[model samples]
Target: MLGIKHNQHTNLYARKCNMKKHLSALVLAVAMILSAISGVLAEDITTCTDSNGIVYQLSEDSSYLILKNAINTTGPLTVPSEIEYEGKLYTVKEIASKAFCGSTATTITLPSTLTYVGDMAFAYCPQLTKVSFGRSKVALGNRVFAGSPNLAGITNYSGVEKIGYGVFDGTEWLRTKSISTVDSAVYLGKVLVAYFGNASSFNISTSCTSIAPNAFNGNTTLTSIDLSNVKSVGSSAFEDCINLSSVTFGNSLVEIGSYAFDGCSSLGGEITLSDTCEKLGAFAFSKTSVETADLSKTKIESIGNGTFKNCDYLNSVILPESTKHIGNYSFQGDSFLSDINAQNVLTIGYDAFRDCSILSDKEYFENVESVLSGAFDGTIIYEDVNGSALVIGKTLYKTEETEINLAVADGVKSISPYAFYAAETAQLLALPTSLESIDEKAFISLSDGTIFVFTKNEQVYSDLESLTSGTIYVPEGNTIENENVSVGYITGITITKNPVKTEYTYNENFDPTGIEIEVNTVLNGKESSYNISQIGYEPSYTYNFSASPIVTVSYCGYETTVITSIKFTSVPGDVNRDKNVTSDDILLLRKYIAGLVSEKEVDLIASDIDGTIGVNSDDLLLLRKVVAGLVSLK
Candidate 1:
């Protein structure tokens, strides 16, 4: 009784594509040789019957889709590696896309000379019981037997390098009796399996380079293991291996993926990563019972959220200086984890280290900017955002922004998610270092959409609609994502925040507080201003004024007006110019203190670039630097 469910069974066979990129030229050469042996492997055809009583034919000569096109019947059919036709040898060279899809075939035997298998080739082959890769030099995929309902067995005799993606995607049979490395393969050391049956003991090798994802997804009985030479591990490689009490990595691997060890409850040991690895994908070491993992030499830039969920035994963690940021909720679910020390981290992502039961040690929260929602909801200490970490152009940006513009620090590697989100209308934004990723709803909600900044991570920008409804601009960079029109205006907005600046807005007729201002009227940015008191007599006229400046008048009882500022050089000899200096400066005239202003600055009060205390020639030069964009005094 076979039935199709909407959405559940849609396009199960859609991914039979064998881009075959990972397959080396030597493998192709081997296939060509085998084809040549078949006397032009283009003339032979294998005639077989499907379970639905339809006669089908596969021509091994010129086309790979020959048999797939004639499908009608369905059953557990084993297409032979070689079919004898007129006493001539014909190689089973190709398998078309979704050829055996939705068929009740319970077993499939790939021919020894099969050179190509199309994408989603056997998807929905519901009753598939076994899939064996023959002596054909090609590698087998983790997806080959995916979605096979009763697939209880799989074995590839070839010495290929990897288990491709989506292979064995939804098979029920797990818990290996024995899986070991054969010829050509150096050694298949840690093919970790999940508990499926009553198997008590298992075997492991010392030469395996990777552990397949979800290899032991539901195993409960497998308790202890030793892997000393394993190099690389894939995502969720040992996920849900419930009974895995203890395990360790071999000495050679560097990179680990998200959720590599997630759900392994009882593993307790001193686990450390090799110095050579660079990428620690989203949740690579999640949900394990390792007491203290050492990450001293890792060059990690971002720590993903939920990477350590449910790890109850973690009491301490030491992050290396090479780390720059930790993503949202990266350490949220660790119920027993207490302390984390990260000295060089710049921005803690949204809710990063959230709910960390005992997170008050001071080593990780130092020098941080833009803590997102719930970042310290239950932390033991109150840590403030680092005002100094807000930088632009490789130096801390001390000036406030009516808008965002990160023109220079192109190599800056972190963004505090929604650092400067504000209430005023902004016109421009600039993003550099090819942005990495944006968190959920990182942008502010607005009626009119605005552009988003960019770093270079592809996955982050692929589906940006999850952030907001406003239009966004994503600049093109060295590494680009989809380049799609569906994702708002993907254009690079140039930041021309040079010395030249101005702004204006029009109003209705007979405006009172300015110089002939009216609705729908515009003025140039370089030369613009308003004339105050033209409509009424005003008292404050003691300042440099620009011609035709824009005026803003609001009523809070009587109306008060605001206008644009004109650049003006300060009076040279005014020590207490605006009378801002209180009697406190007179009582502090001690010796030269480094934190305090110097005597030169005190002698020339007008030259103080910064308004704090004394002023001198250093202060004079600082004033010049501020105008020159080298120093800041705001």
Candidate 2:
């Protein structure tokens, strides 16, 4: 019994030794993990002040450092290229926004590793006089040196790729440099910063490669500019230059920023874009009088919003084949604009061509994949025949009524984009055989219940199948199979040939003998024209002796007018129509010949007594002789 008890005690001691060893191993593992976590936390420190009292912060991914703030540092601060923190080195890549604002630094020297300077980095520095940029190109944020009253010099800025607005505003650098020479322009390296002079025909410096924003804004006296050496024009550079009529763009020109030439009302004639020009920003040429814009040589891919809006005299625009998108109101209110080449345009924005009264190019939207609302509104290509429907150059632009079945007029070659957008619940839509293309979004907003009845089988029917869930039916013999589908409506009429006998006596009936009227009707899904019998149809008009009367020819609820003359039967030498050649008529004729009486007051036909096609002194003499019965009234 004593030996067994000793064995049990030995086993318990052995189990206790194993548990102690496992606990020690766990403690060591946890300590190592904690040390690793603490190391990562140190590196993750978002912000820290360096030994020189300059604040620094980690970049978004903690891969680099950004110089955050040094406002407390006084004169001649030089930013280091790299900052060491927590035993690790990080490259200082950027300066945070407002980093040195309100500082008393006399000068700032940026390191070569810096890529960007945030907005207002050194702004409001009262004593700042100079900023030395790095060797590499740096993108500057807005108002970088604004309100720095003593700042007068900028060094190594030739590598700057972008400069935000008002960067040098309220600074000694801009003020002194702007008027330093007879040119009255400020040049920051190769960039033309600003022009404050009132020269009417100023030429840009030959050495300039770029122009800064608002460079020559609101210059009323600048009538012409020679930009033969410029490469880029910044936003609002020439805005509101009311008299800037001539501009010579060079081949090196690449970019024209937003509102660059906006409101230059006198900028007329052909504007030939440079072949290297790629970007044209929003409202670039809005409200101008440019007669023709030839962009075929440019590399522009899209036209921005309001780019050419309200250009009253813009007659033609030749877009490059590279163009894909047209933004909202791009060409709105161009009244005389008639021609455009946009065959490859993929998307058109809202009101892009709205109120372009005479724009009638049929193939402009052939390959367009998308079209926003009112793209072609108020154009002359479409006629407002009915309140809800329009016929645009052999295309049905839109139909809004759902109560009655819609019949597309015959000879309509296409259906415009979003033609049935407003008629979502429409029952039936009839299509003509003349359709060759259906534009994108033609059946948008249509419901499944809507039926499309085509007069003949067409490839467009297959295209429509992919666009909508509506039922399509092609009838036989150029007629709609469904009787409910209304067809054969009169779309329009034309006065092909006017009456041969236009002249008639006052109060005479309108003679329809020589009149030829061609009536246009949609019959059995086909456009048909026939000459209405001249004797069978009577025209409606009121006789006017002085002016030509408009004769209205109405047939099948469609009407068109023909202009014809109906004048009073003139009696020779009877200037006053009293049915006699008397002394009163001779006196009137004499007064007309003397120029005392106006042409309208006297009957010119009656005053021409010799039938010489005019009322002159010779006619008056003949009338006087007739009144005296000298040669007897012929």
- The C-alpha RMSD of each candidate to the native structure, in angstroms, is 17.3, 24.0
27-134 in candidate 1: lDDT tens per residue?
Answer: 657767888998765433245332233333446443332335313325555554543222343455666666766677766666656655555677667667777666
How do the predictions measure up, each by TM-score?
0.44, 0.56
Judging by TM-score against the true structure, name the best candidate.
2
User: Please, what are the lDDT tens digits per residue for candidate 2 over residues 78-164?
Assistant: 787765444466788899899999999998888888888999999999999999987776777779899999998889887776666
**Whole-model lDDT values for every prediction:** 0.48, 0.74
lDDT of 2 at 591: 82
lDDT of 1 at 318: 72
The top-ranked prediction according to lDDT is 2
True-vs-predicted CA distance for residue 430, candidate 1, Å: 14
